[model samples]
Target: MSQEIESGELDALLPEGTVVRIAGNNRTKWDLVGKKGVVRNAQTLGGWHEVVLEGSTSAVRVQRNALEIIAIIPHSKVKLAGSLQGIKSGDQSSITKRRKKKQSPPMAVNLGKLDEDTLRRYRRYFNLNVRKDCEKDELVFAVRRHFARTKVDESDVIFRFLTRIGKFPE
Candidate 1:
C-alpha cells in the first residue's frame, strides 16, 4: 500500500487532469489493475476521495493512499488518450517488448550463520527438520516452494526473522 495522504493535500496537489497509477490493490471493471487513469474530477467524500477515472462513467471512491500521481497534465492539454499511448510514442523502432523473466530456484541458506533461536523459528514456521544432514540447496528449494504456496513475501519474512534473531538491531 502507498503512504496515506490527507484529503486537503490531495485536493490541492491533484487538481483535475492529473495522470495517476493504481499503486493500491484496486481492480477496474475489466478485472485488471487499473494501471493508469487520468483524474477527471476529485471530490471529498467522508475520509475518501471520489476520483473519476478518465473514459469511465463511474467514479471510484478510495483513500489518498490508493492513488499515486504519476504525471500532472495541465487542464488545457488533457486529452482523452489510451493508457498505453504515451509509452508507444517514443522511439518506436528502438522499443522491443520482452517476455517476463523466469524465476530461478532459491539460493541455499547458510544455516551455520543462523542462531539457535532463529533456526528454531525457521523450522517452526516452515515445518522443516533443521538438523537434517541433507543438501542445503534442497532445504532451500523446499522452503521456497512453501513460501510460494503460502503467498508469503520472502523479503518481509526474512527481515522479520533477522530482526528477531538480533541480526538487525531494533
Candidate 2:
C-alpha cells in the first residue's frame, strides 16, 4: 500500500483515516490528515508560516517567519503533540545543516502548556471554546474564519491560539 501511494495515482484516493508521510527533499516525514487540517500563517511571523497540503509532498516550512522547520499534525495525532518544541532561539540556520548530516529529526511539540490567561483571552475574543482537549488546528481554523468574517486583525486572536497549540511565532 505504501508503494502504491508513492506511485502517485492513488494519492488523491488515500482513505481518510490512513496515515501518510509528509516530507520535503530532506526525507523527514510528518504525519498529516487527509482532510480537516487548515494551513495558515503562524501569527508571530506575519504571513511567513505555511503548511503546504499536497499529495505525497506536503510539508511545513518557515519562510518569512523564522529559520526553523515546522510540521503540521492532525488533531487525532495529539498523542504526538508533546514533542512540538519550537526551534531554540538562534538555531534557525542550523536546521538545514543538521538535516544534511542525517541528524535526528526536529522535535514535535504539544500545545497543552499555553498559559490559561492566553487561552481565556482567545476564547473571550473569538467566542471559541478552547477546552483543554481541543485540537490545535481546529482552534486555528475557527479563529481564521472568525477574523475573515469580522475583518479583525489576526493578532487579536492568533497569539492565544498558537500558544495553546505549542507552535512558535512564525
Candidate 3:
C-alpha cells in the first residue's frame, strides 16, 4: 500500500544502511535528517553535487538541486544497510599534524632523464617550488592533490594515477 508523502516525509523514509556516494556538484550542502551513518566522499560539494545511494541490490541517484530521485532496478527489491559507520571531515589537528611530521627520503627517479614535456606539464600543473632543505618525496606527495585535481580526460586520469602509483591489474 502506498501512502501520500507529506513535507519532510521522503527524508523520513530513508531507512538505516544507506550508502550515499556523492560526486560532481551536490557534495557541499547535503544534510541527513532522521538518519545516521551517512558517508560522504568528495573534494568539495560546491556546485551541483551528484549523490548515488546504493542499496543492497539496487541504487538510486539523488539530485539535490533538482530534488529528483532516479531509481535503479524496479522489481528486484533492494535492502539498504542500516548499520553503517559515519565518516566526517577531519578536524584541523589531523591535517596540520600530518603536515608537520617529516616524510621519508624519495626514491631514485632520474628526474633529469624524464621527458621535457612530461617535466613541463607536471611542473606547470603542480606549481612545485623545490627547496634545498625539502625532501623530494615530500614535494611529490604535497603536490599529489594538484596532480589528482588536474582537468584531464577521465580515462586518462585513471590511467595516469594507476601508472604513477604502479597499480596495474593483471
Candidate 4:
C-alpha cells in the first residue's frame, strides 16, 4: 500500500537550501538526527519523496517523513562602508610573495611538568573542576574527558579556552 504524501506539502515545508535534521526511529541512521544538512534536491520515489543532501557525493535518498526543517543557510553579502576613491594600488607581487612563506609549527609544551601554582591559576581562571593535586597532564586529560561526555567539539572548546586565557591573538 502506498503512503505517499502530497508534493505540495513537501515543497512548502522543505524548500531547496533549507537545512534539516533527521528525526525518526530509523535506528541505524540515528547518528544523523542532530547533524544539520542542506537540501540539494527532492524527488518522488515510489511511496515517499527522497531528499539529497548538499556536499554528499552519493545520491543516498532520505524519506520525507524523517526530515525536520531546522534552519536556512543565509548567503553572505559584502557591503562597502566607505568610498573607494582614496584607496591606493597595492603591490601584488609583495602580497603573492607573502602567501608563499611557510608558517612555523606551534611549540609543544610539556603539560606534565607545569608547577602547582600555574595549574591552580589556570583552574581558577577557566573555572575548571580540576583537582588541586592533579598534574598538568592529568588536568588536560580531565578536561578532555569531561568535554567528550558533554558532546562538545574539542577544538572549539580549546579555542574558546585559549581565547579566554588571552593566549589566542585577536
The candidate scoring highest on lDDT is: 1
Tens digits of per-residue lDDT, candidate 4, 1-170, equal 11233444444444555445556445327655544345555665532323343335343446666666544433342112221112222312111011234446885555556676766676677678877777768777665454345566789989999999999985
Instruction: Decide which is better by TM-score, 2 or 4.
Output: 4
Off by more than 4 A, model 1: 1-13, 25-34, 47-59, 81-170
Q: Please report, in order, the local distance difference test score of every candidate based on alpha carbons.
A: 0.54, 0.38, 0.37, 0.50
How many angstroms is residue 16 displaced in model 3 relative to the true structure, after the best TM-score fit? Answer: 36
After the best TM-score superposition of candidate 4, give how far the Cα of residue 165 lies from its true spot, in angstroms: 79
Q: Mark the regions of model 2 whose C-alpha exceeds 4 Å error after superposition.
A: 1-120, 129-132, 152-170
Let me know the TM-score candidate 1 reaches against the reference structure: 0.34
Sort every candidate by TM-score, greatest first: 1, 4, 2, 3
TM-score of every prediction relative to native? 0.34, 0.19, 0.18, 0.29
Residue 79 in candidate 2, Cα distance off native in Å: 66
Residue 142, candidate 3: Cα error in Å is 2.4
RMSD per candidate (Å) reads: 17.0, 22.4, 20.2, 22.2
- Residue-level lDDT tens digits of model 3 in 39-131: 222213432222333322222333333232222212233333432223332211111111234445874444545455555456566566654
Q: What is the lDDT of residue 77 in candidate 3?
A: 39
lDDT for each residue of candidate 2 in 1-170, tens digit (9 for 90 to 100): 11211222221222222222232233323333222112333334343334434322343533232222223234464322212223232332221212223346675444345555565567677677556566656565555555456665689578878977888664
The best-first sequence of candidates by lDDT reads: 1, 4, 2, 3
